[model samples]
Target chain A: MSVTSLASQLQGLAPADGSYADLFSSVLPAVIDAIGEIASSLSTAHRVALAGTANTFGDDQLNVDVAAELVLRNTLAAKCPSVVTASSEEDPVEKPVHSEAAAVATRPEHCYTVAFDPLDGSSIIAPNWTVGTILGIWEGPTAVGQPAEKQIAAVLGVYGPRTTAVVAIRLPGSSKADAASSICLEIGLGQGQQASQNSEVLRSSVRLAAPPFKTRYFAPANLRAAAQDGRYMALVSNYIQQGYTLRYSGGLVPDVVHALVKGHGVYVSPVTAQSKAKLRQLFELFPIALIVECAGGLAIDPADGSRILDRVLQGTDERAGLVCGTAEDVEAVKKALLA
Target chain B: MSVTSLASQLQGLAPADGSYADLFSSVLPAVIDAIGEIASSLSTAHRVALAGTANTFGDDQLNVDVAAELVLRNTLAAKCPSVVTASSEEDPVEKPVHSEAAAVATRPEHCYTVAFDPLDGSSIIAPNWTVGTILGIWEGPTAVGQPAEKQIAAVLGVYGPRTTAVVAIRLPGSSKADAASSICLEIGLGQGQQASQNSEVLRSSVRLAAPPFKTRYFAPANLRAAAQDGRYMALVSNYIQQGYTLRYSGGLVPDVVHALVKGHGVYVSPVTAQSKAKLRQLFELFPIALIVECAGGLAIDPADGSRILDRVLQGTDERAGLVCGTAEDVEAVKKALLA
Candidate 1:
């Protein structure tokens, strides 16, 4: 069966001005290519061995994690010249990718900053469960200090039985009316194709089911926080009593992406005094928030019910709790945890 | 880059008399091939649509489930003439596959009964999460009235980011010394290969981590049972307080397979008066129990802590709860719930 290429899908979503179109066209496919390479290696290599070092977040690095970070970083630097700054969860600091002469030669509007969590579920990878890569692209030289709304596009690469991506494109400064045109698509990559062959988009235009969902699902991250926070415990108990099907895989990307794929789910990563929020804003939560919102869902800070996109980024490593997914379910989470 | 074929791996483990080896050689690859067909179709097909029919178990049947059942049943019947009886979770009844004359011509000792849950996680499939197939092969006309130990072989097909299978073989009536020779191997099927190509074994001899696991993980199936039983709730509470990582995926095969793949996990599906046991023994629990036990972990009836392998099956539709994984975690569960 004929399938739409991701490049064409991005082209179709390009604005009249075609702003950031060329950058996304070049960067998103390269990111998928990097993921395809990692997926191939994972199928053939020793994945669970320790790399004997920790990321900047102090999480011990797996060999696959370290290798994936390098593959993605190198792929972007070599293939996407428009990326001026690259921030990775493994390194946790924004590194200037473009030379000084190139930076001055290109206008700031033409440059983009890409913050990514390469291999987000390293802890769960050994079990051969699904893990993923997350990329958030911001217009300009850096993602820091800008509100998430400034992000032009985001890509979530899922490494499961198939290598697929959820790509969300929102033109910078799009009006509320244009929100309807903002596209969040799930595309398959290199499915039924050889590893050496160029990545192919096998499926396109994947979206969540329309709201007022019939079946309820929940992925409660940071369940350990329930031990300390009575409110959190009550919320979990309420979900259990209400018979919400549990789908947590101890991975941020798979848990959140499950909500998008299944059409209805609430993924709660709440923070208490003891269980501090661990998801980074620029590297993890922001990209996921944009994808969720573009898919006609909601992503908000659990602390105060504010839209996550409305928050200004403070640093690359800034962390916060998130309650995101189907609109009604997100509201239910807010009512249970806050009200 | 050369990988071993699953056929060869099974052949290598064949006893001197080749008892049940030929049957396994025929049935396992056919199952994996059927899974490959399902996996490839899932990449391109409209998967979330319903067939508008309910299985004998009263669960709504997805189109994929119906297709998968046909594919697996047909593959087994066409490829393995030794399989005299086939039972499916969707149909939930034993049906003769071979002609009466063919069955009468063949020795009863050579014939087998296969009970399987084709497409085990239909509820979780819409989200593109991992689902699987579970198969148990008994040595006679039926699996009923036989202890799980009478089962000569079992196979689990995981349809996740990849299509893979865990094949376990234990010779019927083997001595205690031969118990050490029982095999549970995880083999990748058609990975990085064409759909028409034969299944390949990317890895072999997958085993659980040696016990006394340092890190604890739990997949609490039937979490709603916690609401009805205080003991179940307390057991869950203890796991939370002790900071066991959560990895439940609301799918039996993926949850149990996660334990084997990760080397340490306890999967609990407990029955209460309100939340009665739902897992079918002949199709779901027995095959998984055999695989877990073959992998050096333990599978037990959550009610009485008896070895699941010791229980004699009374019928095809028998239901029970399971607590299987690393020995220490299983003990912890039995203690918290039964002590």
Candidate 2:
């Protein structure tokens, strides 16, 4: 599809997750802290204020929480990921001034935020904060139930963020030696716009899904988050018990975008993906296949690896499925289910 | 204006003080019990779970204390008001039903819910559930500095169920002796839909600002306990003196709905209300006014006592303002402001 068509298609795809996963995920860690901060604010707000009991959330409390949560998200994104860019309520990203002074060279890969709401339903009244979340994204899923491991042996091999997980993609022009910058980088595509060779680069070092696998789906929305979830696999069913999370937020763009920046991939429901042939219809099979392979992962039909999208596009009806974890995880599920 | 149009016009336009006053008054009694129950629940929940160091809410060792205060708005709304509803997540308004026929119609006027937020912050996270809401909702705005006499002496004074206050407009066939049942009958339109001769109700409430006012705005989204809090005429806002609530949720419907139902009127901002006029906008005004007026409270411009959508055409701007207390309290605010 043309860039405009692709962008439109993606926008029409409903963020792959519902409402705003990024919005929620991005704000979670700070939200965690804000609960405490606001609690303090409320407590010390007054000692001699009221003679008796009055039930209410003083105005001062709300403002404190909102401001605190915003700061936490921004601060975490800057440090945790390489190219942490986002479109949130607080600030919009402005196009950087095109400085042609140091031109002629390949654009640097940028780091951005990749997030999944580690916590959902974290709300409480006057007293305490409820719920928790992790929003940064990453490369691939790991074995189920294993604590996220750290990169260096000395440091625990943790996959997601302490508060959130992150995700991003590697760029053709980027080099393996470009790991000096604290933040990762990425080339952000417009809503639904197909990624291109000329797009900016970002961190693609950590593959989101661990048990990398080749996969295919027919649902449009699920396909988006699965593909963007970085695992090229959705954190669909937790059957495999991998460390990677298969999230559902009820939107396509935000979910995918979230996964993209965090190095995770987006996903679609197997049923929706196959009925509309959404994934194949949107992405050229070979190129998408190549991209998934290039990202050091595998892709296949969630039902059965043998019945790949290229192999059996017309014969399937039971299409709802997941797209996450390592190749082994996908292969295991496919082996277990595909008839 | 026709009921439909009236409901539509008065949707967001609240007698700011009215709602505030109502919430404060209603919650006081409910709070007394809510705290008592949570003290038991937290202790039991922790005991049941057997988590270590998780201090039970009822314990005396902890210095946790919960109170609501109203501040700032005294100058802004004339009557310093803060709205609070304390109850368990369970709905308030319990009623004994004899048969299926009455059961359906007897859908309790309220549900019990303890939104007792932590008295402190993460400072209290050590006990986890230590900081949460104790449900309480009052229906009117008694002076913030008044004695507890007002809360205990209200028309609708039940603490077990969630509603700190329940608003009811007598039906064409109802009588004064059946006010509670009549009010229960109108729970659907109990907020501000049906008008009764001399029947005034207290909707939900909020809190915000610095010190002095006993109410504060914890932002409705976070004010879970308040959703079920309500009382009539004898409003709380009694004990905590910090400030009044300024509930805002960036316009999420359910959260706002809860506030409207439990509030004397709903409070929203210009962008949130999504209109240039506060009372005129349909989306912003209808739902809120329906809540406030149907319950017998007035739906006037918080700033000017001129009826909000009461303008002949009921057209107003989206600069959605605070839904003050009961008609009396609202007038007091305008009077204070004008004075």
Candidate 3:
């Protein structure tokens, strides 16, 4: 059977107004290519070793993480002139990009700001568990202070036994009539080939199954929070009593993406006085929330039970708890956590 | 950096006495190839669909399971003459193999019996999560009525974003002075290449960390059992209270392998009145127990806390609960459950 590639699928999602045409055509594919390179390099023993440095968040960095950040940054700067600024989990502040490639007359409206976690789940990488790279492309020079809905597209590069990516695109200000325009695509990257060539679109226009799902699953991130908060503990207990299958892999990208692929799972990360939530807004939460929402799921702030997309991004390093997945499961999380 | 392939590692582990030379050289490589073929076939959409047939255990079999069993059965039949009998999870009864290829004079000592779960965790395959193949190689024509320790070798093929296999070899009657003879190797299969050619030895000799692990992790299978057994609930509660990380991925192969790769995790599958444990003793438990034991870890019967390897295989369909991983964590599970 024939399969469509990621580039072709992205081409189909590109808007008539050309709002994110450059991102769809250039920036995202480069990011995917960079991820493929990282996947190949990960098999080397030295790359998986500790880099002896910490990220901005004080998490110990692996050699793969440092190499991944560099590869992504360099790929974006060299290939995507439309990417005016970029920030990574390793270096949280926004940095200028493509200074030599983009002319002074380059249109700010056409340019995009990229925020990414170059190598997420680094702690679990040594074990060779599935980890990922998360990216959100915003329509302007920076993602700071912008509502998550203002983002044009998001891509999650999953590095597991295979290198695959989840690419979701939603044009800003699209109406309900244009709902079909929002798309989520799961694509497989060929091991040693360019992202545009051998990449296969595994799933197109991905959406969760309508709820009252036949089987329910729960991924409780930061389970430590349950110790300090009785409500969180109660929520987990309820999941167990209801026979919800536990699918947490202790990695944000895999856990969230698993829910999407299964078409029925709830992933809850709650904040508590003793255990603070550590998911960064720009690098992780916003991108993941967009992909979930575009795929007919819900992503919400666990504390206030508001749509995560509606919360404006205050800074690059802003952290928050998220309740995301099948709409019904997310709603259940809100009710249980807020009670 | 130069990397050692799985073939070379197996060659190194092959004993000069030639007890399991055929298994290490022929049968095991054939099994890995079958897994590689299954991995390649899994990407097709049709293979992931339901097969409308149930295994002997009454679980719904996916098309992949049916196809995987055929692929493995055929590969073994065609390539490995040393395999005298084989049985699979789908068809639990042991069946004779290679009647034409193997003469009546074929030595029983050299001939091996194989019991396998062609596709363990088939229930979770639809979501494109990692699943695996489990196999135990007995020294004689039949694994039935033989103790698990009598098995000379075990292989686990993991199909995830990448295809990999954990092959463990422990010659029957090996002494403690020859402990190094029992080796567990984690190998990566090349996506589109032969098992022996492109496969890399990801980890040469796999082992668990010593007790008092700085970071602890737990994978609690059959969480629903907590409702019927207060001790199970208390065990889970203690894990949370001790701040042990949860790393369950809902697939038996991935959960157990995660503990092996992490070097510190306890996987508990408990039996209660309401939730009868479903892991088959021969196909799933014996193979996994061998690998864990070979890797310097412990695999025990959750009910009585005896070494799982000491159990005799009465039938292919016998099922039991298991608590396996780092010795310390397994000790903790026995203490909490047996209290």
Candidate 4:
């Protein structure tokens, strides 16, 4: 059976001009190109050549991380003129929060705000574990101290056995979270689909729905070491007793994305006194929250078990713990934590 | 930098004529072809289309898994005439134990015995986690119940951010375990490096040595559920209490390979009565043991403090848990188990 191109699908599902689809069409290529370049550069020599420079996040940036961000920045600037403001994990410059309407009112050309983590799970590169790129496109500059309710689109490119893209876009006039649609597309990099190819097709995509309840779950256990009290440890122990299997790679993208893609299971980042949440609100939490919510899964806030997307960003770099998955799994986790 | 072809490397590493290197050169393409095809088919629809039919080992055979194994079989039969007998995880066939010399004596054409898990960690596919293909090449039919020390060559193709091949060859003049040399190569399938491409250049080949001790490890905690007694559970608990970050993905290939690539850390699969041992002796255990041991690591037996490669395969389908990693890590695990 012939595969359908992702661009073609976007054309069918989205409006022709200046829509979420159009924005995705422009940004995805740039992202995929960056992935292709990054994929090729994760070599031994490349690792050795990287100066141990830390990013704004304090996680040491490998040469590849900075290079990937450049590819993204350059590609977005060239291809996505609608992007009025851009932010990235590589460089955390907290630009003033200007509404897209406000920015465009002043400079009528720009239409969107973009934020990303160009190369996530960088530490797992040496082990050859799955890692990814994440992009969050907003109708305007993201609100600094508010929930991520305004996010219009989220895309994740997971590099594993194959390069794949999971994209979710909130439809116009559909403000409800469930109104968003998501698709997983195979971005066949270097496999006939050259970096210059205008359209990479969907190998296959199914509308995501939370899978039925299962005992399987994924969580990065490293946070347990940082937890001040024994509460987080006790919760994980209880989950284990309930037969939840641990599937963590210490990578935020693949671990949470696994829950979204598998349609079941929960991925947690618990907030503890000694250990604040490791996932940043702007670059990590908000984007994943939007994506997971769009997939009929819930992203819960640890503070009050509210919808995570409704929990506004405390600051550009505010941190928050997350518990996201199918309703059953999330509820079970919440129950365990409460207990 | 122009990449060298894998075949060219084989030409330089092995005898000019027919040797284990030649055998590998002949069979690797077949295996890698299977990987490229499998990589293309891990879609949501592909997973659903596969009837939940379990394979010989009772693991549900995703249609893709069977298809992948078939690709391996056909490719091997058509390309490599040197293989006397072949076995795969999809269909466990116990072939007669025959030496390479004996097979050559009988067939004159067959020179090597090959066994593989065409798709290791198929269950992890839904989650988009990294998985792999393991190939074990022996001078003769693998001994039914003998240690893996007799392996002449081992290759592991890990499908993660990029598809990579790690090949270890036992040098002819060197009988010591340290005599083996392993190289990590990039098998650029369909990405300009066609199957017909004479060389698949080494990406970055390094003579592996265990990295200095670090308190990091990967163990499939789910195995604890299958453990008959609390011994395995107790040991894992101790590691966790000691702040050893858990890094299990329920995939043996990626877990063990992670240790090899990281240069430090340990990965263990303890034998429990209920779980006899999830890792198969022939296809999974022997190949990984050979690679890890060759890379200056230790593969230990849990029952007695002996090398896993030194233990004979009890049956064609014998299963044994594995504890492999840097010598020091393995020693620590051994001491804990004994305690």
Candidate 5:
């Protein structure tokens, strides 16, 4: 289909089932455009060329601290309505809370919340797996003036690949104790009508050209490693031994985005009840379940197989752990919770 | 990057490693485009307007079959040096197979081969699941005047979603069986790279949406069911108590794709070696070991864990009954077979 046809099709989405899709269609292009525009201006990755060169290009945590902040700033500045930004970074900066991006708090807090990571996979900045931007589409900003604790109801992290968006959302009405979310996919194919199934189980054997792990497979060790520190070595050291590399961008949005695109997986922060600081960001677009599922993957909280959407219904925001290719892969970690 | 930049970047991939990468990259876009185009033309589709109405589609196996063939034809046509062609649908034909086309021949002694299932999931075409294409990239096309048997050599299967590309090559300059293809990605992704360690284990609880059977993970169960035909449904029913939906597409590529995308652990196609005619379509991309491992999946020839690739190298392409996916998932079936 031609780009013109795709634009029209995207416009058509507005009429499909009311204005939600329309509103989404209208804003997505601009939001993505803004993301791309200012990303380079950020001081975070001046030396970096691509996200995958983390091992060779730069440092992971510094990458996120600089890049995520820059992305959040640019995204907030581009739009007029978005207010009270949150992040997977340090904590929810309800204005004074975060010294950076203070203009966001000054703006009106209504209609739209976007959670994202400007640069993903900062850990391997030297030889990045893939650095990306993740943004979640949200309805409205969280409690702007209210104490940091009394913020909005649902939110998630969104990631961007080259120029794609992936949202991991907090199902409507999640509580502080269960900052849960659900993931669905919305691939902008520009094509109408479609179909297919999800490959829930993907047993692939791969050895890297640069070999990180010997890549062996067994149950216990694999589970334990990820649970211990997903960013330690390779978050998973199952089939491919040599202890596959582990990665965390320090910013959750970018990490999740990388998972969504590259077919990795997502992770909840794995902290205790998320602090108001934890309610840092909320996603605005990108389906929560579909994207992960489409790539033959899974996304959910690791603490309990609790329906992630339901968890979002409960109260909580700062949750963390890896979501994998299958419910089994995710649940395996949940079931093995030593904590 | 702008569209021009993105396109340029993709365009440059052809020169990165070898002409092969370039050739593959050039054809991939066209291949994906063909799949999309054929999908749009499906007789059973709802034209995107009435898609909400589920049952308004057709059930023509021919259309499904043609779609797969079209992909291979068009894709191969995009690549020039490919001197000859062979397909499970038809015998070897000239270069540049047309879209929605195939050639069937009765010739016998051909040694070179390329087998494929153009469309694998017509059975569950409506619900938007279990429909896909499998392309086998083989070496040595059927000889100018040889039979089908003489032309079947290297195998490659390009499956959709859950499906994968299993490619077995004679490797560069070496013809010996052991000198066979090195471990390349079974599923297609340049080569293996380190995966996060967090994604190491599987959940303990096994929850399937279909019938329970030990050895059968997912695939051409029609052959297996027929093997146990008299008691096939009954046997399958007994296993159903486990809670899996026969969610299989009841088609070749579709079923396998569904199983893989859903991370169903193992996908089984247990047609006895004797049922050659029934199992003539499956294809491969890279060696199964590499493919499966790359996709975070596994592939086990029904017989044993010893390298199936090794076995296929020595054996004729006539061998059948392939089981593939996660190591553990396939192991369960392997143990089930012993039992």
Candidate 6:
């Protein structure tokens, strides 16, 4: 019934001298708080009412998405002052901040860049499927097209039947090493230890459902728009013939979270000749790659068979061919593509 | 910000002398209460911990499913003593109760049969997609093989990003008429108007969204096992070539709820050669048929293009090819099948 708070989890995340620990301790709690706020607002408000009139990146903004973006921005300004630059799928371009508040944060020496999709899959909200908020932390004040390898940490807060967080912190000099050298954890949110009369309060950071992963697969047909190609369709048909059940909800967060919890499965969003890839590298794919790799799974770029975490990010809008799952599953995807 | 409660909505549902209103008033609250219990349990407990070790209908049971079934059964026994016989997807057969207690109910003259899938799409829980609890209410303790038209009311409680209830009530001699003659309302659950320490649930019976639906579609490839057949594949290929995107998550509740909320789309589960129909008529198909029909949509058997509500239920396990959505969409499905 009791869950460890995110604060404590971050406190113990790294050694006292571990820079990654200090960086996460500075950043994650604020992002987690924003997730809690979004969950509350969404649980009660009507979906259409929350559909904001503004347009962002060719999509209509949900008012809640805007609120979530502000919440994260303000929280970073206050609690994670080391975060100097930020970009979000909900915003037109990366913005600079925290120059005034840098003195308050724990690590002033390291200026971190935060790339996020404050509310991924917001359109799916009307249908009442799961959605999530994603954040990736990298070295100070990065540009829009920074590569995934520059990242130090990645965290995803998934709001579904219940709220859960998946966090991955990469230690120094370990990008090429196996999962045993990295830190990956799934955190379950429970009632805050603070006994407030407000039922909306939540407690996060209980490390539960750590992954070894079971076999499963999830990819919306839309994500597999590439499947319209005979080659890609053949790849999908291979999975179907192999008895893989489709588990996509058209939401990146829940789809990836399913792999984390279930412990096995491929989530493919391949590039199509006529259309670009759908999952953005910085905002969506990179953070998920970090979490998946740290969880003992592999996130592969099907085009080159390179690790997703090592892919070159072209821009904030840059997308890639993604195939993430257990190593064997990812290999299966690769083999099918090549075949 | 305040919304109406289910109790208040149902109170105003039918005229004072309306027998349909009285039946729903006796039944819906009890079913909704069970839904509340399941949502609470599922939101807090671990999925594997909640996995009931027992298998039912040839699948591993989630503990929440068994608990949910018991909750519904007990609620019916205690609150709706007029419910004389009951069956559930979790239970193997129909069970009788309340022969003596029927005298204590408000509608003693009626013996209602309650058949339900206490937790539909429960297997999808591990992935944290939307799942729901469904109930169908029929007259005179109807047998498993009774026709769907014998039912006077139907309700489904969807536990998704938010909790919602969709109810359809048909007054006597109104079956032949269109949706205008029926009462279809979508209720949003908030804290009880009662001063309980439980969550603040209100209900909204807004009529913002209605049918004359847009063109969209959802059917899991798994349910489209029939699609493996050359003819069915051709029909599906037609939809794909026409640019209809796949939106299925293999959960009837959320899939249907999407159609209801978005005011569009079709959800199909056709019988395959290797397997019977994936959805049960009494538990899943019939109740949804009632709700779709009441919402100005249609539910038809793909085999003969007859209305789903008019089909004779062969037994509790009897299955049918389901095609539910707007009337135009249903006709499209009929044409595709017959072609």
Candidate number achieving the greatest DockQ relative to the actual structure: 6
Off by over 4 Å in 5: A1-73, A89-113, A116-317, A320-339, B1-68, B75-82, B88-113, B117-134, B137-168, B172-281, B284-299, B303-321, B324-336
How well is each residue in B1-339 modelled by candidate 4, as lDDT tens digits? 236654555566656565565455665655555555555554223233223211122267776677667766766666666666778776778443345565455573446667788888866765567888888877665455545655667778676765556666665545445534443333333333243253254334433354444445656534545235466666665666666656777777788766666555578777655555667778887888777767777787775767877766666577767788777778887886656
Instruction: Write out the backbone clash pairs for model 3.
Output: A161-B161, A161-B162, A162-B161, A162-B162
Chain A TM-score of each model, in the order shown?
A: 0.89, 0.28, 0.92, 0.81, 0.51, 0.84
Across B108-218, the per-residue lDDT of candidate 3 in tens digits comes to: 457888888988875555444567889888888898888676788888887764567888888646732113658887776765636655676767777777766667789
Better of 3 and 4 by DockQ: 3
Worst 10 residues of 2 chain B by lDDT: B67-76
Per-residue lDDT for A1-339 in model 5, tens only? Answer: 233432343344343434344233434444444444433232123233223222233233564446455655554555433334444333333232133454545554335544444444353222111234544444545433222222222212222111223322223333321212322333222211110111010111110112131221111111223333433213222312322222232334433333332333334333223211122222211223323433444445444544433323221134334343334445554554423
Local accuracy of candidate 6 as per-residue lDDT tens digits, A125-240: 76567778888988868845666668878878776666666777777776552466677766555533221111221222211223342334556335335336666666655565
Q: How well is candidate 2 docked (DockQ)?
A: 0.02
Candidate order by DockQ, highest to lowest?
Answer: 6, 1, 3, 4, 5, 2
Native contact recovery (fnat) for each candidate is: 0.42, 0.01, 0.34, 0.46, 0.00, 0.44
Per-residue lDDT, model 5, residue A97, is 19
lDDT of 5: 0.35
How accurate locally is residue B75 in candidate 6, as Cα lDDT from 0 to 100? Answer: 74
Please report the candidate that would top lDDT against the real structure: 3
Sort order, lDDT high to low: 3, 1, 6, 4, 5, 2
* Candidate 1 global lDDT: 0.74
lDDT of 4 by residue, A43-113 (tens): 22223321221112226776667877877776665566566677887776544334555545556343677
- Quote each prediction's TM-score: 0.85, 0.26, 0.89, 0.82, 0.43, 0.86
Q: Cα deviation in Å at residue B205, candidate 6? A: 8.7
- Return the DockQ of model 1: 0.35
lDDT of 5 by residue, B103-207 (tens): 233221322244454554443332222244544444455323332222222323322211123322223333332212222222221111111111111111112
DockQ, all models? 0.35, 0.02, 0.34, 0.33, 0.02, 0.41
Instruction: Give the interface RMSD of candidate 1.
Output: 4.0
